[model samples]
Target: MHIEKNTFSLIEIPKIIDEKGRGNLSVIEKDGVPFDIKRVYYLYDVPSDAYRGGHAHKEQLELLIALSGSFEVVLDNGFEKKKVMLNKPNIGLLIPTGVWRELENFSSGSVCLVLASDVFNENDYIRNYSDFKLFVGA
Candidate 1:
C-alpha cells in the first residue's frame, strides 16, 4: 500500500427521528460508499485516563461519532496528522482505510459509537505501532 497523508473526508450520518415517541432512532447507511456496515458497537462511561481505538484498518472503513459528552479523534496518515474534537450528535468523522487513528481524551459519561464497514478480523487490523508505521511507510 502507498503511504497516504491527508485529511480524510467527513460523512454525515443519516438520522431517523422517532415518531410519536413510541419508536427508537435509527441511522441509515447507503450503498456506493467505500465501505459498508457489518458490525456496530459503542463505548459508554469511558474514563478520562483511558484511550481507545489505537489502530488502523487495512481495508475496513470506520465512522466515529460522539453521542454524548465529548472526545477527540487523532488521525495520522504516515506523514501528516490531525485531531478532530467531536461533541455534536449529528456530525461524525469519516475515517478511510489505511489511516492510523486513536480515540482518546473522553469526558466522563461519554458514549462513543463506532460504525464499521467490516466485521472484526485480526488480519485486517494493524495492531502494532511499528506495523502501522511500516504499512504507511512512515
Candidate 2:
C-alpha cells in the first residue's frame, strides 16, 4: 500500500508539570511511539534560512520533536505535499517511509530531536525527488 501525506500524524507527548513553578518534563517510553526506537539524534544551531532533509526513506519511520525552539517540516508523499510547524517540545510529528521530508524555517536556538525505527542505512534512502517519485510510481 502507498502512504500519503494525510497518513502522517502529530503526536502529543505526555508531560509532567511541577506545581512549584519549577519546570516541565516529558517522556517517551515503549508505547509512546508506534515503532520501537532504534536510533536517536538531534539537530541544533541551524540558521533560519538553511534547509535540511530533502530525501525519502525506503524503510524507516521517524518521530521529529522540537526539543527547544521551532522549525517547519515540509513533507511530500509523491502525490501531495504538506507543511508542518513544530514549536513545542511536547509535540512530535510521525513520518512514515516513502515520504520525502525537508526541514526549514528554524527559529533561533531551535533544536530538532529525532527518533528512528532503524539505524543508519544509506541504501534505504532516496536522495533525489525524481527517484523518490519513480520509486513510489507517482
Candidate 3:
C-alpha cells in the first residue's frame, strides 16, 4: 500500500429509498471503502464545542463518516493542509496513514462512525504535533 501522504478522498455510499424512509449501507469488501475492516467505533453525543482526533497514525487507515448531523475534518500532510465537511450519512472520508487529522465543529447530537483497517494499537499513533512533523520530515 503505497499511499500518498496527502491522498484523502470522499467516497459515496449507495442510499436506498422506498416507502419507508431511507437507509444506506457500507461494505468494506466493496469499493465503497478501500480497506479491510478490522475495527469499528463511533462517537456521539459530543458537545457543540468539542473536538476529536488530533493525531496521525503510522500504519492504520480509517474511513470516517458522519452518520448524523455534521462536522469538519482538518487534515495536514506536514506540508499541505485541507479541510472537509462531512454532513451526510452516505458519504465517507478516507484517511490514509501518515496524515495528521483533526475533527471539529461537530453539531449537537452528531454521530461519527469510523471504520479502521487495523485493530487498536497505541504504538502506531503519533499523538504529538512536534513528533509527527519530525517523523514526516516536515
Candidate 4:
C-alpha cells in the first residue's frame, strides 16, 4: 500500500437550515441529489485526561463533528502530524484513510458525533504503533 503523509482534509458541509429556525436538521445532498445516511454515532461523557482513537483504518473514511463543548484531534499521517480543535456543531473534519488519529482534550459536556463510510471491521484496524508504522511504509 502507498501511504502519503499529512493527508487530512477539512471540509465545509452545506447546511439545510434557514435563519428562522431554532432547531437544526441534518441533511446531505450532492448536485440536488440527497444521499441516504447509513450510520450515525455519537460520543459523550468522555472522562478527562482520557484518550480515544489510536488506530488507522485500511479503507474507512470518517467525518467527525463536535456537537457540544470542545475537543482536539491529533492526526498522524506517517511523516507528519497536526492537531485540529473541534468546538462547533456546524463544522466537521473529514478524516481520510491510512491516517492515524487520537482524540483528546475533551472539554466539559463535550459530545463528538462520527459518521463513517463503512461498517465496523476489527481486521481493518491497525492498533499497534509499530505495526501501523510498518503498514504506512515507514
Candidate 5:
C-alpha cells in the first residue's frame, strides 16, 4: 500500500434528520469505504488534556469519526503534516497506511469511533517517530 502524502481525506456520510431526532450510518462495502472492515473500536472517557495514537501502520486503513463531543487528529506523512478536527457524527477522516497519527485536544465526554481494515497485529505497527520517518523515507 504505497500511499502518497495526499492520500488522506475527509468523507461525509449521509445523515437522516427527522422530527424526533437525527441518525447516521456507515457501511464498508466496496463503494462505501476504501477497504473491507476487519476491526472496530471506540475511545471514550478521555481526559481533556489526554492524547492517543502516536504511530503509523504498515498496511492498514482507518476511518475515524467522533460519535460525540470533539477531538483533533494530527497526521504526519514524513514530508508533510495535517491537523483535522472531528466533531460531527456523520463525518469521518480516512487515514491510509504509512501516516503517523496522534489524537489530542479531546473534549470531555468525547467518543471516538474507529473503523479499521485489518485486525490487531503488533508487528504491523511503527511506534517510534524516528523509525516511522525512516520507513516513509523522510
Candidate 6:
C-alpha cells in the first residue's frame, strides 16, 4: 500500500435521543466532515451476494454511513487492507483520497448513504485494481 491503511476510520455522528415518547435523531452539520460536502446518495435493494465500490478516487473524499441494516467495507491503501462492519445508523466510515474500497456482505434491506466531497466526475476515479496499483505507484 502506498498510503497508510490507518488513514481511514469511523466517525460518530452526533445525535439527540428523546426521553419522552419520541425516537432518536442524528445530525451532520456544516463542520461534520473533513471536506466540503458536494453530493449525497444512497444505495438500497442490493442483493445480499452483490458488491459495490470497486474503485478509488484520486481527489474525492467520501463518508459511508449505514442508515439501515448492515454491510462490510473493505479499504485498501495500496499496501494494506482493513475490513470494517457498518451496522449503526450513527456511525460512518471516512475514506480519504487515493484509497481503494469495496463494499459487500449487505444484510436485508440495507441502506448505504454516501457523502462525497465533490460532484460525480469520471476523471477522478481509478476503476481497475491493477490500474489502481499502478496509479499509486505500487
Clashing pairs in 5: none
> Can you tell me which runs of candidate 5 are displaced by over 4 Å?
1-6, 19-30
Q: Name the candidate that leads on TM-score.
A: 2
> 27-122, model 4: which lDDT tens digit per residue?
544421212335679889998698889999887767788889999999987888899999877777877778899999999899998887677889
Where is the poorest 10-residue window by lDDT in model 2? 1-10
- Residue-by-residue lDDT tens digits, candidate 6, 1-138: 132333797789997988995999999987777778999999999999999999999988899999999999998888889999999999999998879999999999999999998999999999999999988777
Q: Model 6: how far is 15 from its true place, Å?
A: 1.7
lDDT of 2 by residue, 1-138 (tens): 233433688999999999998999999989888888999999999999999999989889999999999999999888989999999999999999888999999999999999999999999999988999998889
Q: What is the C-alpha RMSD of each candidate to the true structure, in Å?
A: 3.9, 2.3, 2.0, 3.8, 2.4, 3.0
What Cα-based lDDT does every candidate model obtain? 0.78, 0.92, 0.88, 0.78, 0.88, 0.90
> Which candidate has the top score in lDDT?
2
Return the TM-score for each candidate structure. 0.81, 0.95, 0.90, 0.83, 0.89, 0.94
Per model, state how many residue pairs clash: 0, 0, 0, 0, 0, 2
Model 4 spans > 4 angstroms off: 1-6, 16-26, 30-37
List the pairs of residues colliding in candidate 6: 1-78, 1-79
Q: For residue 82, what is the lDDT in candidate 3? A: 96
- Candidate 5 residues 38-137, lDDT tens each? 9999999998888999999988889999999999999999998899999998888999989999999999899999999899999999999999999999
RMSD of 4: 3.8
Total clashes in model 2, counting residue pairs 3 or more apart in sequence or in different chains: 0
Which sequence of candidate numbers ranks them by TM-score, best first? Answer: 2, 6, 3, 5, 4, 1
TM-score of 2: 0.95
- Indicate the residue-level lDDT of 18 in model 1: 77
What TM-score number comes out for model 4? Answer: 0.83
